[model samples]
Target: MQNAKPLPSYLVHRYHGWKATTWTENRAWYRRLADEGQRPRAMVISCCDSRVHVTSIFGADQGEFFIHRNIANLVPPYNPDGEYHGTSAAVEYAVTTLKVAHVIIVGHSLCGGVKGCHDMCTGHAPALEEKSSFVGRWMDILRPGYERVKDLPETERLRALEKEAVLVSLENLMTFPFVRSAVEGGEMTLHGLWNDIGEGGLEQYDPTTHKFVPI
Candidate 1:
């Protein structure tokens, strides 16, 4: 079992085709960017789910997005303690050091993290207190959003709450001095996106319309 037989037929075929030609030839560019400090133009907060690779979903090339993903793509209000704060630190660095032009908070359909938050608010979530898991801690950021939208229907409400969570993170983005300063100076913009995974469609939040507009 240790000695694998042969490459899978699909991968073997792909290796002789697009994957081989494109990514293989482009490896040098990626290496060069890494060798130099990457100055990405955008910062994306996305889901930690394996299925939602932000770069792949956005069709972004290497070094294009300074991306951070937590459960449900949450961004806690700026809090700088001595302990590990991976997501918040990434945001601070991106907005301050990297000076990204835009920050996008991305949410998606049928997100497990969103479901977890919903369940937690309704007292139906798994007994998570016993374990010190990142998911448990990270989902806390969506608590306010869940509570605010709890009166809506289950299927529709969860989805709405998920979008509300993205907006909440966008609000959190403003809590950072660097981000707020940049936006006030008209140097940066914040956006919230909701992706319908079932239909492979995207909607951008419009504050004026108070709705998600297909994009």
Candidate 2:
């Protein structure tokens, strides 16, 4: 901590802003949420992109959604190997402990992590391909999704893989026994979403239509 810098001035200003307006307006709701504990109705798994604000995008109040973020927003297939799994642990807690009724995997355009994975796989970024690359290994979860969209034009592959990341995560979510049980028992629902950051548009995956439709 000796070498660590103080909090950014901009963040300090933003916190003051939130405390003044957003927090003040929802003071009672915030207090109630604190006293009663969080009972979020939904769990959202999304990318760790700075531009993606899950709560703001959904217009959710404090403690309304349990969110888990990771590179490319990809969820690895359920693996109980007695190893550290942050995202899976969050999902477990959300489903089994929090009893969330819905699970949403939100993917977005121009995701750096997804782009890195694409570059790594296509030999565009050799550093990420190295075995020692932590990000490279984590992004490997999206490899299957990339394979599904590999044939698209160079310009379009990235966008296709972005959606594929959501699809893969949705499929991976079912691999969790508790998640599958809840979903099958009609206690929980799963959703996939893709957002176009530049366009400010959202698309939801429609299983019946097997497509991502504008919502």
Candidate with best lDDT: 2
* Candidate 1 local lDDT, 124-149, one digit each (tens): 86664336756767788888897789
Summing lDDT over every window of 10 consecutive residues in candidate 2, give the lowest-scoring window.
54-63
Instruction: Quote model 1's TM-score.
Output: 0.85
What does candidate 2's lDDT look like per residue over 93-194, in tens digits? 999999999999999999999999999888999999889999999999999999999999988899999999999999999999999999999999999999
- Best prediction by TM-score: 2
lDDT of 2: 0.93
**What is the TM-score of each predicted model, taking all chains together?**
0.85, 0.95
> Can you give the lDDT of residue 42 in candidate 1?
98
Checking candidate 2 for backbone clashes, the offending pairs are none
